[model samples]
Target: MEAFVSTEDEPDEVVDAELVPGDSHLPVIRHQTPLVPDADPDAWLPPEAAQDVADGIAQATRDAYELHFTQFAKWCAMEGRRHLPAAGDSVTAYVSHLTRTPREKTGKPYSPSTLDSVIAAIRTVHRDRKLPVPETKGARQVVTGYRERLALAKDAASRPNKASPAKRDVLRRAVRTLDRTTLAGRRDAALMLLGHACATRGGELVHLDIESLTPDDEGRGFTARLYRRKLKKWQDVGVFYDEDEELCPVRATYDLIDALELEGHTTGPLFLRMDRWGYLAPPMQREGKTIGDPTGRMTAEAASDIVERAMARAGQPGRWRSHSLRRGFVNSAREAGVDIVDIGRHGGWADGSKALIGYIEEADAFSDSNPLAQINEAERRKRGAHDQH
Candidate 1:
């Protein structure tokens, strides 16, 4: 059977192509021919170019790019502008719109970091299609300048839009509010503590597997092998149980596991999803799998949602995110006089991590370690000695 493949530079045209079978229901495409321009519709796309388009991006990145592209397309449709091979002027205009308008779902403006992702998505589509990227130097300047201005305005208003890291007191308050009697409540409590102790990102926490954790020598804690997505590597993370069983992550995790009846399942996702009725999702039976097999996993975004709800219930003000736990751990450790190197290693950061250094500097700024404070203390002692003399 012949299938129609949409070609670039030909909005109303489609070419007959052969479909290849895929692992799932959707058929994989071989793209029998190259994506030639309209002037040479029959000419094949260069083999190297096609290969670059195929291999340059990972599946997850492609999915994200497509999602961002769709959002841009929707905005273009509303504004009656072309989206494909998007114009520089249109992209600048879109940036303006993004800054000026709030998103419908969250009723908030997109963060500068999110805006960068959207721009990267737009560039990816253009690169795939072999088109000139719409975000030219001028367009980039306009967007970046606008972001700076927006940040300044926010600072002036004393409403700087940034996630507040979960400090020790904040974590304690949140844990105290968690109703650990219920299965979901227990799971959430464990999640909050584990997130803080391991300093794992939301994505890493969601993707944890039973096999990834090994018991410590005393069996009071577990060593977790976490996959760091940014560094594209696995890291051994140590998570110890607190003396207070009520707030101990290891105990909470074990309790949740017992409640879910996940014994003997050492290869499935550690965290499972919850149903609307407040029950943990029941394990499913696959074709060749055992009955009551737990395979469902939580998502990073779900982790954020969980944190946000917990913070609200704990009476915490200001925006809090999943990253807050990680940040909180770093700052708390630094404030407690933990060495920066040790903190970095615990957080799965590379040696001499500039990011970790930044955290340490920020934490030290308010401490007695500050140069000005040390100078003031020395001056006070000198003045006291002179008076005694």
Candidate 2:
């Protein structure tokens, strides 16, 4: 495995270094890449060097930070910042861009917290790569300055969007109307219901298995045990709905089992793809089968595409994304007066506050105000009168 590192040293010129060439035991040369005189200094590091630095990081860390760094790299490429100067202000300018760039879809800029992650990703690369990423004063002070700018941006993004609970119910209704007959349809319905009912993520849905899910006894509700990827967390989710309830994930799964006429299936996929002849095929056909792959698992992307098609046919107006299921459930749970901590439990979130921070409480929760609240208020007034007597 050979690795090439590129950098810019002076205006109108470039520098390069050769390391880890094809043969593991060969010596390499380090060349200085000069910058063009007319070129502007990059915010911190050149794209090639940044890429090399990022690639050298461990796989787990890379997965965690890749999105942030990739977005930063994209911004740099767009801005034509191809090299790092020994000044911190250059980095600050990049930070300003992150804070100021309005999101095309949302028309809002990045928040302080989000910008913080993006900057931290870049800064970590610089520090690890031993780049001179400073222009203002000290490195720490430079980061602080960037943070202040991010804070300012955060303030701008803070204004909330107000939507009625009725609107959310409308969305929920749309989700419920999806055809639950096809394998894809059934899977989509279950996924959406689990997201809305049990509060699950797409990744979590991808990970579902018979081993991870089980029933209580002869005929009760099922328990979905989810392994959280983000926080390496785990949660036990219980699902049960009344016999007459529509849009019920639990009932949907029950109906699926009965439809398949599966008296008992302890193994294999809980969800499978339907064949052209309209037969449910297990995710993996037997190895000796005429047209089945040796691998038995369905990829997550396939799962998402199924949902996408389902939503399209269902005539749902808003985007029905994988996270929508999770977000919808969280939104409903919060509005239902489920405590923040319990909400975290149901959603497999490590921290309730941070989870709830992204979720806006739906307006409809207040529609049927708690009668207990009114009773408590009345009792409090009576107690106050007694005290006065």
The best candidate by lDDT is: 1
Go through the candidates in order and give each one's C-alpha lDDT: 0.75, 0.58
Instruction: Name the top TM-score candidate.
Output: 1
Off by over 4 Å in 2: 1-87, 97-114, 127-172, 241-245, 254-319, 334-337, 357-389
TM per candidate: 0.75, 0.57
Q: Which ten residues in a row have the lowest lDDT in candidate 1?
A: 1-10
Cα error, candidate 1, residue 212 (Å):
1.7
Model 2 lowest lDDT segment of ten: 159-168
TM-score of 1: 0.75
- Write the residue-wise lDDT of candidate 1 on 88-119 in tens digits: 88877777778777767887766666666678
Clashing pairs in 1: 34-45
Off by over 4 Å in 1: 1-64, 74-82, 100-110, 155-161, 218-220, 262-267, 276-278, 282-294, 352-354
Question: Residue 276 error for model 1, in Å?
Answer: 5.0
Instruction: For candidate 2, write residues 178-211 as lDDT tens digits.
Output: 6666544565566656556666656677667656
